[model samples]
Target: MSTAKDPGKGAEKAHGKPSAKTPAKPAEGLPAKILSKILPPAEAPKEPGEEEGEVPHRETAPAEHGPGPDLRRLTEIARALNSEPELRHLLDLILDRIVDITGAERAFLILRNPEGKLEVRASRSLDREEVKKPTAKVSRSILVQAEKSGRPVLTTNATQDPRFAGSDSVAYMKLRAVVCIPMIMRGRSVGLLYLDHRFEEGAFQGVDLGLLEAFGAQAAIALENARLLQENRVRQAELERSKEKVEELNRVLREKVRRQSAELDQVKQVLRERHGEMKLKYAYPEMIGRSRRHLDLLRLLDRVIDTQVTVLIHGESGSGKELVARAIHYQGARKDAPFVSENCSAIPETLLESELFGYMRGAFTGADRDRKGLFEQASGGTLFLDEIGDMPPEMQSKLLRVLESGKVRPVGGKDLISVNVRVLAASHQDLRKLVEAGRFREDLFYRLAVITVEVPPLRDRREDVPLLVERFLDAFAAESGGPRREVAEEAMALLSDYDWPGNVRELRNEVFRACALSEKVILTEILSPQIRERAVPRSLPARLDDRPLKDLVRDSVEFVERRAIQEALARTQWVKTETARILGISRPTLDAKIQQYGLEKQG
Candidate 1:
C-alpha cells in the first residue's frame, strides 16, 4: 500500500521507502505471538475486498465502522481512565491502552511540567509494561509539531517523509508509522500522546488517529481531577494543624490571667494589714488624757478613722473639736493629702460663701484672681468646718448641696467642681435644737452626723487637771527658757476645785499666767482671783482653846514647809542635788528635811 500522512492541514502522499529488514523487539507483558495477531506484517498482502494503493478516508471511516471494534475499544479505555484517581497509575494505563489499540511498538504520554516544558510522563510498549529509554526511542520533531499547532501529526513512513527528514531523533531511531496527537482541554493544548513503529510503514491508519485524539481528551480530564483532589487534601491537613495551635495559645492565656489575679489579691491583703498598724501608731498623739471620758472619745475616734464618712463633733467652744478632726485625717488613708480648717462663725456672713466655695476674678469687688475654695483645696483629704451651727441659712443650703453631691460650685463660677474631701463638721451649739427651730437643715444634719464625737468639758473630768497643769508648766518653761515652776498644794487645790467653764483652754491660760508671774512656787496669792474666790474655805477649829496657841502656829508653818519640800523632791525624781537646786537649799539640808518628815519616794 502507498504511504499516507496527516500533517494537521490535510492528508498527503508519503514516498514509498523499502521497509527495514530487521524485525522490532516485542513489547514486554504481551507475548510475541499475541502481538503478531494485533499488528500487520511489514510485507503483508492486501485483503481481497481492499483495492491496491487505496487509503481510508478519515471522516468516512468512523461512520462506516459505527459501534465497530475500534470505537468500542476507545469507549472501554476512556472508562478505565476516568475510574483511576491516582495520576501515576492513570498515566501508565493511558500509554498501555494507546500502544495496544494502535498496534505500535512504543507509546509515550508527554505532559507539561511547572516550567512549561514537555516531559514524558508515561512510556509503554504493546506488552503492557513500561518502555526503557522512551525519549530516545520517540520522534521529538513529531511531538513538538503536534504540541505547537495543537493538532495531530501522522506519518506512515517517517524515514522517507520530507517533512521530518532533518529531525535527528527520527533519523537515528528510523521511526515509521509515527502518530503524535495533542491533548487539548479548555481550548488549550496541555500535553501530547505519541506512538511509533520501527519496521512497518502504514502501521497506524487515519482511523486510529481519530480514535487516539478522542482518547487523549478523556485522559487529560482525568489527570486534572486527580491533581485538584490531592491539593485539597494537603490544604485540609494544614488547616487542622493551625486549629490545634490556636487552642493551645488560648489555654496558655487563660492560665496567665488566673495567676495575675491571684497575685493581685495577695497584695491587697498585705496593704490592709499595714493600714491598720498605721492607724494605731499615728492617731491622736497630742490628745493627752487618761480620764474615762477621754478614753471613750478616743475609742469613738478609732471607729471612724480610715473611713470616708462625714463626722459631726459636738462640744463647748474651747473643747478642741478641730484637734479631733486632725486626728481623724492624719491617722487615715488620706494622710498625705491636705487637712483644711474653716470656722463658720469666724468669717463674716457676706464673705463666708466666697471663702469656703471660692469665686471667679470678675465675680465680685476686690476679687483679683480666681481662687480655690476650701472644698477644692482639701480634695482627697479632709475639710473641718468649725461652729457649723452659726453658718448663715443661705450658706447652709449650699454646704448641704456640696455634702450630698460631693461637689461644689464656686461663687460666680458656672461649672460645678467635684471633690473627694471627707467633711468634718463641728459645733458648740445643739444642732438638733437648731433643726427643730428651723435654723438648720435637718437633711444636712443627718448627712454630717453619720458619726458623732462629743468632747468632755474640763469640769466633768477633774482628775485630768493635775496632768494638764504639768503639761502646761513644761510647755511654758520650754518656751520662756526659764526654770520649771511648781504650783503649791493650796494653789493646786484651789485651781482643781474651781469649775473651768472655759474647759481645757481656760486651764491652759490660767497656768500660763501663773507661770509668768510667780517665781519658784505658785502660791494661792498668785492664783486667778476667780479660782481663789470659788475655793472652799479652810475650816477654823470651833475654838482656839482646844489647842495651845503656840502649837497651832508652829504646826501650820511646818505643814507648809514639809509639803513644799516633798513636791520639790518629787519633781526632781528623788535626786537630792536637783531637789536642793530647785528649792534654793543645800543638798545636805534637803536630806535632813526628808528624814525629819519621814518621807520616802512612792513608786
Candidate 2:
C-alpha cells in the first residue's frame, strides 16, 4: 500500500499567504492543527466483489458517478448556505459541505482581499497549529487551469502531471488527485474552492466536479448578496449619525435666533423709552432748578440714575419725592420697562399686600381676574413705594424677602413669581427713627436705602420760588386762556417772606388760584388769606371809633388803594406802563386809581 503526499507542507510565507507561483497549499499555524484534529481523512469506496487485500482498479471506474446521491447532498448543502447571511459563517458552511460532499481528504477556501490578492479565508482537514501558520503555494499548473478556463480543474495524478511533475512544491509534498473550482460572481472569478485527496489517484470524479461547480455558482451569488446587504447597513448607520448631528445643529441655531430676537425687542423698547425721556426732560425742565441745593440733589441723581441701586427719598410730603424717583427711573438702564408707583399710606393695609404682590383670580372676594402686582408690573423697571415708612411691619418683612430674592409670592397664591424691579422708596418720616421705634424693619430700611436722596423743601430753596411761580403762572394762564398776571411788589415781598408750610405743592395751588382770579396782576388781596392777613400787623386798629362798619371798610379800602398806586408809580419812575404792571392793574385802571387818589409821581 502507498501513502499519498501531504500538500500542506508545501512552500509558504511566515504569515500564511502564498506567493504568486503556487496556490491551494495546506492550512498552517494553530488553525491547521485544530482543523486536522476535527476533520477525519476521507475513506475510499470498496470495489464490488473485491477481496479485502486487493487494490481498487480506478482506471475501470466510470468517468462520472450517477447524479442521485450527488443531487441529494447538493440540495442539503444549498439549503444550509441559503439560510446564512454573514459572509464568514457562509464561507465556513460552504467549506464544510465541500469536504463532506466530495469525500476529499482536505479542503480550504481562498478569496480576493481589498488589495486584489488571494488570501486563505477558511480551511478544514489540517493540524490546528498548521492552520495558524502561513499559507503554502500550490503547483502553478493548477492555478492556470482554474483561472484560464474560469472553470473547475481536476487532476487524477498531480505528481505525474507534466505541467507540475518537476515542481518542488508537488515533488516534496507528493501531492496528487487535486480539484480546483473557481467561485464566480457576475461572470468573474472572486475566489477559488480547492479540495484534494492524497491516497486515491482518482478521488474526484465528473459528478463531484459538476456538483461543486454548481455549488460555487450559487455560493458566489449568496456571498455577494450578503456583502451588499452588509454594506447597505453600514451606509445607513452613517446616514443616521449624520442626521442626528444636523438636528443638534438646528436646535443650537434656533436657540441663537431666539436669543437674538429677544435682544432686538429690548433694543426697540429702549429706543422708545429714550424718546419718552426726551419728552419728560423738556416737559419737566422747571423741576431742574438753578438753586445750589437743587443742583446738589441733581448731582446725586446723576451718580445713581444709571444703576439698579435702591433709593430712599427723604423730604417733606409735598417736596417732589415722586418727581425725583421718576427722574432716576427714566434715566436708568431699565428705562424701557414700566415705572409703577404705589403709596403705602394711600392704600388700606388690608389691600396693600394684594396691590403690591398681585392675586389669583379666586384668591379672595371681589377678585374678578388675575392681577399683576406693582412689583411684577414693574419688572425690569422701577417700583416707587411712596410713604414706605408707613407700610405695615408684616409687609416690610415681606418686602425685605422680595428685595433679597427678587421674587414675590402673590397674596393667596402658592407660587413665587420672579421679578426684576428696582425699588425707589420715599418717606417723610425718618426711617432710622422708625427702625429704632420698631415700626419699620431694620433690614428693610437698609435694603431700601442703598442710596438716600433728600429733596429740599420749597422754603429751603427760596431761590426756586420765582422760577416755580413763573412756571405755574404760565401753566395756569395757558390752561384758562386768561391774561398772564404779574405779582405786585408788596405781594411778591409778602410771598417771599412767608415760610411755606405746604412746600411746593401748596405754592403751586396758590399760584394757580391767584393766576385764575387776578385781573392782570397778583395783588396782596389776591393771595391766600394766610399770606394776606400775615402781611398786615395785628396791632393795627380793628375799627376806628366803631363808626358804621361799612363806611370804615370803604375808607380803609380807598386808603390802601391810594397807597398802592403811589408806591407802584415811584418804583416805575412814574412810567404809566411800568406803574400799571407793578400795581397788577391795567393802564386805564392805574390812571383812574391815580386820579381818584390825587397821587403824584415821585422824583
Candidate 3:
C-alpha cells in the first residue's frame, strides 16, 4: 500500500521525477483542493500486481458502486445534518448520508419508541410498501447487540459470520455485509444507524464504520435541537391567540360604557326641562292681579299673543317690561320653540351685529367655529330685544332690513337665511322722541311699533299692592324656608301712597328685606326710608313755630341734601359705582356724603 499525500504539493515535477522540498498549490481546476485541506489525498490508484515503489495511475471510483467516505466527505455530511433545523428533514438527511458514506445498498435510521421497539424514522433504498416492516424484526441480531453496547458493529459476510451464525434474518435474507452504529446523545443510546449490502461482500470497510458512527452522534444533536425549536414555535402561537382574545374583550366593554353614558346624558337633559317649567309655573301663577288696570294689560297681551305682530313695550326701568314679554311668549303659539332674548345695551356696539345675526367660522379672533345668533336660534319663536333704543345707529339699519324682509344676513356671510321669528322690542326711552332727535332710525321704529303695549307704573296700580305684597311674601318665604311675613295696616297704607320710582320691582325688594329682618310681620320700621319718608312729608309744617329764621333755612337745606342723596342711592340699587355716576360726583365724595348724612339702607 502507498502512503497518502497532499495533492496540492506537487509530487512530480516537469522532469518526470518527484519533487523533494518545493510544494506547489494544486491547479485551480481540481476538485480535490477541498479534500486536501481536510485530509491527505488518497494515494494514486495502482495497477494490477504493481510493486510498492511503482508509480500509480490516477483513477476515479466506478459508477456501479459508491466509494467509502473520505475525511472531507465525513465532515460535509455532518455539517449538512446539523444545518437542517427541522426533525423530519434531518432524519432523511442522516439516512442518505449513511448510504453514501458507507457505500451501502440500503440504509435505515431507527429510533427507539417508548415501548423499546425499533421504528424506522427514515430510510433510503426501501420502497413505501416495504417501509411498514418492523425494523427490530427485519434487522439482524448484531444491530441490537451493537445499540446495547453503544458502539458500531460491522460484518463482511453476515450469513456466515460467527457473531450471527443462527440469526434468522441474516440467514433468510442472505445478507453478505452490514454496518450498525448506535446514535448516542447525552451519554445514552437513543437509536441506531443501520446499513447493509446484499449484492456484494465487504462493501463497507473499517474506515467507513468510523464515519457512520461519527455522523450518528451529530444526527442525535440535530434532532433534539429541531424538537426544541418546534416547541418554542407552538408556545408563541398560543400567546398570540391569547393576546387577541383580551383585546377583543376590551373593545366590547368600551362600547358598552359609551352606550350607558349616552343614556345618562339624555336623562339629565329631561330633568333640566322639567325644572324650568316648574320654575315658570311657580313665579307667574296666573299673573297676580286684582285691579282693572292689571286686567286690561293682560287683555292687551291676549290680543297680541295669537298674532305675528311686532309689539313694542314702553315702561320705566324695573317696571316689568321683560315680565310682559315672557308672558306673551309662554302664552303664544310659538311657546314650544326657543324664546331667545338679548339686551341690546348689555353688548358692545362692535359685537352687536354678530350677537344678533351670527357669524361664520374664522370671522374674528377666537371664533374657531360657526355660531348661531339670537335671530336664528329664535326661529319659529319670539326674539325679545330688550332696551332696543340703546342699539347702535348702524345696527338699527340692519335690524330694520331683517324685520322688513324676514331674512337675516350673518356677519361675513354671502347668503340670507329666512327666519319665522316674532320680534318683541322694549325700552324705557321714547323711540318717537329719539327719531325726532336724529338718534334713532324712523323706519326701524315703525317696524317695531306695529302694535304698542304700555305697562303701567306701580303708582297707577295702587289697588294691586296688597296682592303683590302677599305674593312676594309667600314666594320669598318658600325660597328662604321661613314663615311668610304679614304687612301691618300702617305699613300697607304707607307703601300704597308712596310714588314708587322703581315700580313693583322696588316694592318686591322692600318686602324681601322685611322678610329677612322682621319676625312674622313686615312693620313700618323695616320699610325702605323712601317709603317711610314719603309719609312724613304729608305731615310737614308750612311754617316753623318759635324757631330762628337762620336755623330753619340751614335745617331745610340739610334735609333737602339728605333726601337727594337717598333718591340717588335707591336709583342705583345701592351700588356705589352707579350711584356716583348718576349723582355727578366722585366715589370718594359720595362715600363721605353717605357717612356724613347718617343714612341707613332700608332695602
Q: What is each predicted model's overall lDDT from 0 to 1?
A: 0.73, 0.69, 0.70
Query: What is the per-residue lDDT of model 1 for residues 58-151, given as tens digits with 9 covering 90 to 100?
Result: 3211111322344446556767887988888888888877776677888888889899887888888777777887767777788878887765
Ranking by lDDT: 1, 3, 2
lDDT at position 191, candidate 2: 83
Arranged by TM-score with the best first, the candidates are 1, 2, 3
lDDT of 1 at 220: 75
Q: If scored against the real structure, what TM-score would every candidate get? A: 0.44, 0.43, 0.42
Q: lDDT tens digits, residues 1-603, model 2?
A: 111122232111111332243222222221221222111122222345755644332211121333334444555665677789888788777777777767777776777889987777887773312244325745445765686788677777788777676667778768877888888776788788877778887676433344566677767766777788789988999999999999999999999999999889657644543343212222335474544467568767777886778899999878999999998887778778999998899999899999999999989998989999999999988999999989998888888999999999988889999998999999999999998888889888888899999997765554456667777878888988877778776676566445677788898899998887887888888898887765442212233644576545554565456556656776777899988887778997776555433343321
Query: Residue 376 error for model 1, in Å?
Result: 0.9
Cα TM-score of candidate 2:
0.43
- Best-fitting candidate, scored by lDDT: 1
Q: Which residue pairs come into collision in candidate 1?
A: none
RMSD versus native structure for model 2: 25.0
- Model 3, span 1-603: residue lDDT tens: 111122222223211333354333322222231223222223333345866665333211111212222444655665686689888877777776666566677778788776987778777763322244546434658777887677677777787787787788788888887777888777777788777777887676433333455566667777777767878888888888888888888889889898889878646643543343212322345466644356568767867787889999999887899999988888878889999988999999999999999998888987888898899999999999999999999999999999989999888788999999999999999899999999999989998999999887776555466678878988898999977778776687677667678988898898888889898877888888878886543222234656577545654654455556767887777898898898789998777666544444542
Clashing pairs in 3: none
